[model samples]
Target: MASHRRPTHSGLTHSARVTVLSAAAATAVAALGATPAGADPQTSPERARAAVDRLFQEAEKATERFNSASERATHLREELGQVQDGVARGQERINRLREALGSLAGAQYRSGGVDPTLSLLLSSDPDTFLAQAEMLNMVTERQHSALQDLQRAQRSIGQLRTEAARDLSDLERSRAAVARHKRTVERKLAQAQRLLNSLPSEERGAFDRASRSGRGVLPAVSGDAPASSRAAAAIRAARSAVGRPYVWGANGPSGFDCSGLVQWSYAQAGVGLPRTSQAQRYAGRQVPLSEARPGDLVTYRNDASHIGMYMGNGQVVHAPYPGASVRYDPVRMMPISAVTRV
Candidate 1:
């Protein structure tokens, strides 16, 4: 059986992790107050906008964690199903072995009720007695072998059951982690929304407009061609998704998050990609930003929480974040971490 080991976030319990994350989020929101005390009123709008942007970034990180946990849960569930199926088949085999052993015992019971040695001694013909003795010995050996087979089968099933139980536990933990990360993401987004709402109408409109800036317009990408046919196909798929809503955790024709868009686009190109940006960062050979071509994955931030498909000419098509549509942005949007050529 394959190992179903899951990565742990911390030694903390699920509830404890939730509490810690919530507290951290609250502290961040407090520090990045909607309006700091005695601050320059003129820069309040700028400060608020910055704070909201930070919150959105934090939420994206949480969303990636959520994706990781969710993916783990999916694999664990699959492994659990396989283990359970093995146990069931093992049980059926054991039943057949049991029936065979029972039949052997019944044959022995229906035979003459004297000890084998006594029967041999009481037999009138020595040759006939010897032949009967050999047959009885063979029956005993077969019974012993059947018993051993049953014992081994039982042991194997026991081990499989244990594995299934362990997988179930891991699955539960993954589910908890998924829920916790989801809550963290929600909290961060909510804080950002509240901050945005607190801004003056004009400032809020500006923020909204900036978020929508990528909609309905795509920068002309020139210079380097896609490194591969698959890359080119993925780029075309991503471009077709322009103006789609940025739905967190979605990887589809309609909506997508950062890594989701990457994975979905690659999938359209008949290639597979990992579920999270952090993992997707290593999906292929790493290259410097200078070598980036259309369809290369351009990851952002040291943790690789954000990713976009490079479209050459210093442009990329990405699902920015909530309230934004999939659109074109500069490849240097948030400090390029790594450019991966898939």
Candidate 2:
């Protein structure tokens, strides 16, 4: 401290460093002050419409998935019931055979408790009993036949129970899938509703009016017969439900999903089709788009989640979406996947 020692060669003391940092901080503060205040945060109408459209499309896809899973669950439940019923009948048949075998054993015991017939009846292994009976001629032909029937019944019961278990498992999985789709659809619809609500009041009213207008009127139906009798009948049936509501997972007289509409219409025509749009796409012969007739099934998008009945003049009658009725629209509304002549 007493010495007049020169500063370090670098010549940057602590005070100088602090001065430089202060200058930098001031510059940053000025830059921050230059930014605009009160910038607009609201979404534009066009942007909002696009977002809503996307959400509705997503909801429709999920609705189709829900419908398909619900249908599969129904079919699986019926099959499980049938298999379980078969198992029950087989068990009853086995009980009858056991009773018959017991009666035979009691009759043999009255004569002599050590007879071959009684021994065969008491054998624990059905296969071994049959084998021994064959080699030793220990049982009558009728008894041999009875043992074969018992073995058959046991095998049938085992197979049926196995099948029923599999169906039950499949049904559970389908139910889960249905529930998941339902949640997806609900989330999408809620988002869409929020977007719609965010719109200006006048725009919201316009949207509501546009959605409801001309919805009750049925489009003109083609009078000519379809490519086939079944197709014609299906088209007629679909025409009958043109004004019905679009209800997800419904396949009936009141309302329908896209694939449900096709499935229900085809069922009315005495032709059974698969429940999902993707499955229904391959349920019949594929026809060229130009060759599509009034009754053909029109699938849309690459995934084929949406379907409709072809009405002549380039129109398709379909359960369009959640808010839309079963209305007629141009076939070119979306990209076509296939035209199935169902």
Candidate 3:
């Protein structure tokens, strides 16, 4: 037989080829092990920023819900107070009526010894005759009237008590809603913060620079005159708050949310607006976006969850989001829900 030998290729021994294949398999395993589980190897900074922006928008929506619930709770508290006061006043009236009826009963019992009509007519003293006559008339007519009044007061009190109970229940539900919305806002903001933190330092710096560039700049209005004097005043008020930080549910000189900024600006012009964005959407006459003027309320998003004061020239002054401030943006930054002329 011919000399037997292990198969070999490329002038390498069979055992050496086996060793090389084993090493390549180990390298592949190591590469797979080095990557974190469920992580995308090609995630980009733009995707992260977009996610952060979405979270901020979600947080703003929750903030509006919180504001609405808080306002409802306040209204319920006032209504409950009024109902309680009415109940108390009704109870007082009922007590006085009962005392009056008791006195009338006592008078009738004391005069039970004689016929009331005969006693009154044959009385020697004029004063006693008048007193007994008046009492007899009151016993016939005023007695029935007082009883009816008492019944009415009792019914009114019962209705007020029922209202109070209903309001209390509503208030509790509103409070719970407020708390739930608050948690949602906090959670969303936290998620946004985490996304921001995950970004590279250069990207984060670029984002901060972009935010700064957008804020504190009041672009000139295009129109020579406002739609009205109140509108002019509101535009001035909004322009004055360009650099104020955005705060959820805050309507103030220092900070504001989207609708809060609009509400506060209009309030400075002696115009009252609703507290939340959705309500403010219908607070005034609706106008088309093309006809929007300075101080017109430009509501955004299909749900009208965001609002800004139009500053003419296709610009709007709005508190954009939590990390942003009162700033100027294009009127069409998001979808135009409504243009309200307040």
Predicted structure with the largest lDDT when compared to the true one = 1
Per-residue lDDT for 1-342 in model 1, tens only? Answer: 000011233344555433333433334345656554555444444455557777888899999999999999999999999999999999999999999999987775787656767878889998999898899888889889999999999999999999999999999999999999999999988888876665545445545666766678777667778999999899889999999999988988789998999999999999999999999999999998877788899988889889999987888888888888898877776777899999
In order, candidate lDDTs are 0.81, 0.74, 0.77
Please, what is the TM-score per model?
A: 0.87, 0.75, 0.82
For candidate 3, the lDDT comes to: 0.77
TM-score of model 3 (CA atoms): 0.82
Candidate with better TM-score, 2 vs 3? 3
Estimate, for each residue in 112-214, the C-alpha lDDT of model 3 and write its tens digit: 8666798788879999899878878867798889999999999999999999999999999999999999999999888777655644454455556556445
lDDT of 2 by residue, 114-201 (tens): 7776787999999998897885564566567778888988998999989988999999999999999999999988877766665545
lDDT of 1: 0.81
Candidate 1 weakest ten by summed lDDT: 1-10
How badly does each model clash, as a count of residue pairs? 0, 0, 0
